[model samples]
Target chain A: MSGVWGHSGNIEPMFQSATAEAVEERLQRPRGWNRRNSLPYTLVFLIVAYLGVFILFPIAQQFLTSFSNNVVGVDKVTWVGLRNYERLFEDDDFWFAVQVTFTYMVFVVAGAVSLGLVAALLLNRKFRGRNLARSAIAVPWAFPEISAVLVFLWMCNPTFGVLNIFARLFPGIDANLNWLSDPNLAMPLVIALSIWKAFPFTFLVILAALQAIPREIYEAAEVDGANPLQALRHITIPEITPTLLLMAVLMSIFSFKQFTLIWLTTGGGPYGGITETLVLRIYQTAFRFFDLAYGATLGVSGFVIVLGLTLLFVYAQQRQDRARRR
Target chain B: MNRPGNGLLLPRSLSMGRRDFLKRTAAAGFAAALATPALAQNAKIKIPLVSWMWNEPGRGDAWRAILAKFHAEQSDVFIEEAGAPFNEFTNNMLIQSQSGKINGALFHTTPDLVVRLLRGGHLEPLQDIVDKLGIGDKLSAAHDHLRIDGKVHGLDIVTVKFGLLYNSAMFEKAGLGAPASVEEWVETSTALTKSPDQFGIYSPHLMSEPGDFWFILQQWAVMFDGVWAEGRKPQVNTAPVIEGLKLFKTMYDKAMPKGTDTATANQMYANGRIGQQLIVSAAVNIWSSSGPDIYPSLRSVVPPGPSGKAITRIHPICVNAHASDDEKAAAKLFVEWLYKPENYQELMERCLDVVPPYPEAIRQEYLDKQFWAEGYLAGKSITPLEIMGDYIFFNQEFGNVVMDKFSEVLVANRPVEDAMADAQQELEKASERLFEGFTL
Candidate 1:
């Protein structure tokens, strides 16, 4: 885990014995900040850089695994030119995993953000137990993801499951649905669990944004012959849209990167490799299969995809916001 | 049906068959692939018993008892049994075994690994230890599991058979004695499938790993006609293999009861509804739990085979070769003490109708009292050693490739001979490229 500011050679010796004048100069504050604070900055940089070796290095290692042509039992690398990448490209299973991931993110984000906004708008006024409810919404985020996944696995069990028993009351629905086992059902079930586990974050963010909206703007709207709906649309929504966009981006990244929950409930199997996310693939390749190079390749692929989407999103959002501002 | 987001390549399985063909055509060659414990010279040494089964509660706790007994006032040296899940026990030890993080491990993997482990000097050579310990004198030809390149790797528990473990009541109704041969097993299975209401055997074909189809079929093949490993080469695709396939296909085709959906089934037999479970004998504890409402009454008899002898596959036994000299010596001594008939009897007697590993370990007094076998059935004892010794499990690379081919025949509906041909082709290829890394 190397810090971005780290050096290849030891910087420790450079900072080992700084003169008193240098130390004193670094401590002194000036109007434009003329003095070089190399000692303190280097120390901070090195500390951060040290953490990168453990954390970032392993991540880099996973990215490396996804590319290499290492078989589990075999010890040599045959270096099949993009053979792994080529295989991954043609794999119907990986395509399904990608679709599942997209569906999960899109459906979850839509459900959580819209529902969260409504809840936040409804709870805008001071009410009894309001703070308690707001805090309670954040509670799901604190529960361990593994525990939540297990709970979902149990609730979704086809036989003797609580959800199936209750679902039976519906006239046309099957009495038993092996939610996790069905390739058709696993993603939707995972989407439901993801929404359940994640909506609270949206609620918290939206509620904070809602509270921060100035009452004066709404008062002006009301005075201008705007009904409650128009006032919310014209004033409230415009005010919180920026924060909502930011939260959406963050939440999208969070959902895309979510691993533990999916890994726990369904070991990314049943669809013959469809359920496995790129991250899960990285994990399996690096740890389970010990194809570190291939695991690393998965990480790199996941990174480029996620990064490209995020950048494209930010660029589009910025352009739209700038035009509106002008 | 839709394309995956960020999917960069085709799937492994679809391409595996084709790539395997090309690779096998290119490789088209073959190759061949432990030891007893060492005594702790100074009594200050400690070595690890890296095994898988000890992860279960009783076995893990019972390991402590054995260690305690061995240390019985022997002042200083200690032995620790560190167990992980079956899958992880070896790979975890590999880092230590390679980097010398920890000494010796007891694990099971392809027999092809023996040459690499010995080549990199990752394991201590053990033929000398067996000679020094005089264990060979006690047991005839038992150390073959470890013998590779004319050297030994580790002492191993023999192979146990994968077969139909039937209830006596069901057998009475079917009028089938222990299947005397593979043909009889097929006949009995088809007969017992009598009405749509009952099935002869319970098998988990859909279990995650396809390897299990081989685990059971190999036992049957070994009995009828014969498939074998000589100098660690799998001369399968023999008559025995074809006969074994037909036998299994016969069972799967006509036997398995309807409504016994095995999707992600963790325990089909624990509930005890199946007349007979075709599974490994390791599940005895699940069937032996108190409360008839909860558990099932189960016993095992040999499925009569082509040779009139029912054999099984054995879990492997190994010692750490990478331990310090003193530690290696002590590990050998400890293992020797452990394999002594008394200790062997102690471990084998628990929780199942397990056959003893060593021939001399099962005495009348010990067999009668051990917890797993006590009065569960009329059978006095069933030792895993009744199955082939290390020859099948650890001596050769053939069983694995043959097993995969067998799966092709059974599940994929490939012709038995064609699949065997493909299997032999692939296996011959796999044997050559098994290990190329020389780093220690």
Candidate 2:
């Protein structure tokens, strides 16, 4: 255990044994006897308590609510075990919302990350007005969501939207297009707005990650007769793959819970919930339809989907880490 | 520490010991605690009157004047304005109610919202106030839904009935008189439209504004003598509804400002760009201020459809059951004062409202003076409860299904019959779960 902190070739086993011994010793000590050791445990307990109240408790409430007949204005809100879940499985609209949520998540995640990477790579180079360019790219992220939606609504307005100006530049689009009302265009327009509002954040994070990579790595690749593309492929990409993965996970979560932008813009419609995500559906069900029990059921199902996504991403990350080590 | 500028030692009396400072602070806090109720008792009972009308253009000012008059006349109660915009108001109140109480001691409820609140037991019955005012028998039939177990739970502050409100100036420009039939209405609208500049008609169709969209959509069905539901059964796939939707689609394609939001469309209407709107009569007040030029030319007609019936909705102001006894009493006092024939008539005249909750609530002389009232008065009145049957309790939900499917007809060019068939099936399926224990 003493050699755990020493420069040893067998460091992993020594560290594990030392950790085990420390835990055993701490447990054997009288409560509050070791203030230094107790500090970390106290902080951990505080965090757990915070999470339990703010996150876990509400989730538990929603889970309990999912099994009840708790609709607003109902005569009795008695427990109706498994009834809501049974209905969920047969509900077509709920399934459509799930599909829409995933589609939105994928497109937004991919679009934001790709656009972020491109912008980051471009801005990372030595260029004139680079600072100004970086500041400009961050504007969208800084802008309030409601304001952005308002501006976007104005720009996509059928009669007077500025979007029509650019749209009519192409032949055969002679009339002002119904940018959001058209079912074919609603989802795409909403996705584009989400990406625009989201990509700036990804750009800032990816830029910081790019700056963290040593310039020597690129120089080393250049000295070995590597072209710019080869250097980018071998040196730059490999160094940032982990950051990109992390961004994808973060973006997925951001888009998964996105409500204001979608709710404000298309309101989960042009027709038949073309843009309805799980969040919007939960809201419409609970607030609009006054079906709290079913809304909770939908929420629980969404929580499961999110949990599955997180586990899948964790597994992928673990595999990637193992590959990196190899 | 030395005092600034003077550069002299501070007086010994200026500094106090920590214990003395703590004692003084605690004494001040204790004094405040003791004095608070006395001060509050002396002050007016500041119970907030929550209403979406507070955010509306003409209605807001009208209500504010009424509130001012109330303040001038009363001393014990003070009503503060609170609530969100029209679009968010119902859901905000619903959310508040779901959490055990509404946001304010007194709040306004839409035609559908009062029913939910009444069933949820969130309303304090105002039958006593009505009886005191002796207007219970004079109350319009629209107030029937607000009754539960023989007690009136709310008092209608405004009764909004739909009509084909059009700009006679625009009609004159197009050399078209008011249409006599549905086919004539379509031809007139198409003829009046000059795309990219002016639209012939605008009824809220955007899903982004489902509250307005669904509210107006119900009237569209009514225009053709159709109801969305009957006895918890949907009549969406029926012939009259199909005809109503087809007419809407034809107008959408040929005459509407396809993607314009209601606010912008209203501005367009004010500016004489939109020729007509199937709007509530209460909305006429907006033109008096915002569209002074066009307001004079504005005239309403019975919807030139087979039915010639308009859906009349009553927005009621209710006292919160969850409020304290003092607050509830104060709210009821305000309601009683506002419902007096003189005050109510003044409110109607100030708001330029044509409909009244009771006959004596309005003056025949005032009605005669309103040049635009003829058509609104001529139409047969149908309440939402009658048109929707038991589904009136789930008005927004029923409207959502209808609006969602019909959006396909407007957007994807899906046939109205096919879209409506899908809607009929969806509604049929939803009824099983939505109306499990619901009694109307």
Which pairs clash (backbone N, Cα, C closer than 3 Å) in model 2? none
Give the per-residue lDDT of model 2 (tens digit) for A1-326: 22322232333442366687666753554553244446789999999999999999999999999999987776567899999989999888889999999999999999999999999999999999999999999999999999999899999998889999999999999988888988889999999999999999999999999999998988888889999999889888889998999999899999999999999899999988999999999999888888889999999999998888888888898899999999
lDDT of 2 by residue, B1-440 (tens): 45543676777667668998999999999999999998987788889999998888778888999999999997999889999998788778877877887878999988878888898999998889888888878888888888988789988888899999999999998899988799999999999999889989998898988988998888888888999888989999998889888999999989998878898899999999999999889889878888999999999999879999999999999999999999998999999899988999999998999899988889999999998878898899999888898888777788899999999888889999999999999889989878877766
Q: In model 2, which regions exceed 4 Å deviation?
A: A1-50, A159-165, A168-176, B1-46
Candidate 1 chain B weakest ten by summed lDDT: B30-39
lDDT of 1 at B149: 70
Residue B353's lDDT within candidate 2 is: 92
**Candidate 1 residues B1-440, lDDT tens each?**
33343565556554456779877756653211011133333435655666665666655555667668888946555766665786565566544443434544433333334433444456656666556656665543434444567566765543343444666666676676656555676777777765334567755442123234334555555446455443334455667756766666667667754213343232433433345665555555445543244334354554545453344334545555555666667666766776777776666555343555556756677656434332222222223222322233232234444553554454446787887777667655644433234232
